[model samples]
Target: MTFEFEDRKHENTQLPNNLSAPNPGHTHQLISIMNTQKRDRFELLSAYLDGEVTATERRQVEEWLDKDVETQRLYSRLLNLRSNFQSLPVPSAQPVEQTIGQVFGKIDKRRRHRSVAWGGAAIAAMVVAALSSVVPGRQVWQMANVNNSAASEPLYVALNTPVVEIPDTVLAPAHKSAPAQPAKLHQQNN
Candidate 1:
C-alpha cells in the first residue's frame, strides 16, 4: 500500500501499517508479538503513555520504543496531542451554590404555582357544590339519587324489600343557618 505524509517533518517516516503482522525481517518480532494489528499497537502505546499497562507490557513497550523509530515517532505524536489538549483553555463555569440555588428556586416557584392552582380548583368546586343545591334544576346529585332509587325499587315496593334509611333533611327544603358559637378551648397539662 502507498504511504502519504501531510507534514514535511514526517515525510521520510514509515506509513500507517495497521496490518495484522509486522515485517518478517524485523528482529522485534522474534522478541515478542510485535506482529500485532495496527489498532492493537496504538492502544498498547496509548496505555503505556497513560501508565495503565502491566509491568511486562510496560517493559515490552519500552523495548519497542527503544528499538523501533516508527514506535518512537508514534509515541512522540501521541505526547504532542496530549500536551496540546492540556494547553487548551478551559471554559468558565457557574458556581455550584449558584446553580443549586437556581434549581431550588425554580422548584419552589413550581410548587407555589401548583398549590395556588389546586387551592383555586378546590374553591371553585366548593362554590359549584354550594350553588347547585340552592339553584333550581341545578341539584344534579339529588335528581340522580331519586332516579337511581326508582330504578333500584324494581316494579313495585313490597314490605319484604330492604328499607333504605333516608334522612329527613333530604325531603325538607333548605333553611338559613344560625350564627356560629365561639370555640371554648380547654387546656390540660400532659
Candidate 2:
C-alpha cells in the first residue's frame, strides 16, 4: 500500500501506525481480514486492551500481534498518549461563597430596580383613581372594603356583569316601558 502525506509539517514525523500487522508476507492475508468487515477494529482492540475480550479472541489478537511490528508501534503510541495525559496540570478550585455572592449581587440589583418601577406605577394609579373620584359630575367611585363580608356577593355580581353593556341596559329603562311595580314582601309566622 502507498502512503500519502498532505501536510508538509507531518511529512517527516512517524504517524500512529493503526495497521494490525507489520509482516510483508501476511499483508495480503491481513488486508483480506480487514476487507471481510463486520464489527469495528478499534472497538475490538480497545476491548482486548481492557482485558474484556474472550480467551479465544484474545489468543487470535495475540497471535496476530506476535508477527506484527505496526501493532507494537500502535501499542507504544497509546501508552505514551496515556502517560502524557496523566502528566497534565489540573486547575485550582475557587471559593463557593465568593461565586454565590457575585451572582446574588446582580440578582439583588435587578430586583431593586423592578420594585422601584412598580412603586412608581402604583403611585400613578392611585393619583388617577383619586382625581376621577373627586371630579364634579363624575359618579363617586367606591372600593369594596375587604373586611366587609356583606359586599363580597355584590362585588361578584357586579364583576359577572359586563361593564360596557350595563350602561345601555341599566339605570335608564326603554321609553316604551311603564312605571315599574315594586315587589310585595310577605312575612311568615314561626
Candidate 3:
C-alpha cells in the first residue's frame, strides 16, 4: 500500500507544462515583503514632508512617489496636514526687555512683602522688650520702698519740695571770673 501511494503522489506532482504553480506560503511571504516596503516608503515620505531628509534622501523619496501612486497619495496627505498646521494662528512673542521687567517687578514685590513682615516682627519684639524692662523695674522699686520706709519718705519729700524764685541779677555774669552780685531769694509754697 505504501509503494502504491508513493507512485500516485509522484504522478500527481508532474505538470503538463514546464511552468510551476504558485505556492500559498511563497505568496504570503511576498505580500508581507510588499507591505514592509510600503511602510518604509511611508516613513520616508513623512521624513521628506518634515524637511528632515537629506538631498539624496529627498531624491529617493521623489523617485518612489513617482513610481507608486499609493506613495504619491500619502505624500499629498502629509503635505495637506503640514499646510493646515502652518495656517493656524500663533501667539506673538513678547519683547525680552518687557518680559525681564515683569519678572523683576514680581521679585521686588515679593521682597517688599517679606520686608514688611520682618518689620512687624521687629516692632513686636521691641514692644515686648520695653514692657519686660518697665515691669521688672517697677517691681524692684516697689520692693525697695517696702523694705526701707526712711528711703521711701525721702523720695516723697524731694518730690514735694517748694520752688524757690531767684532774681535775674544772680545769673547776669556769663564769665566765671566776673564779680557776682548777690540776689534775694523768694520761696513759693506748693
For model 2, which pairs clash?
A: none
Tens digits of per-residue lDDT, candidate 2, 1-190, equal 0111112223433323544468775677656555433123344455667677766667755775687676666666766877898899887777999889999999999999999999999999999988987789966758886766776655434567666575656577677776445442222322
Across residues 111-167, which tens digit of lDDT does each residue of candidate 3 receive?
999999999999999999888877843554343335565666644334564457666
- Give a tens-digit lDDT track for model 1, residues 1-190: 1111112223433433543357665546443443434546687789878877777677767888999899899999999999999999999898999999999999999999999999999999999888877888653553333456667765856677447876768765557665455442223322
* TM-score pick, better of 2 and 3: 3
Clashing residue pairs found in predicted model 1: none
How far is 189's C-alpha from truth in model 3 (Å)? 95
Q: Give residue 8's error in model 2 in angstroms.
A: 38
- Quantify all predictions' global Cα lDDT against the true fold: 0.70, 0.62, 0.69
Where does model 2 exceed 4 Å of error?
Answer: 1-39, 92-95, 102-190
Off by over 4 Å in 1: 1-42, 48-89, 138-190
- TM for every model, in the order presented, reads 0.33, 0.32, 0.35
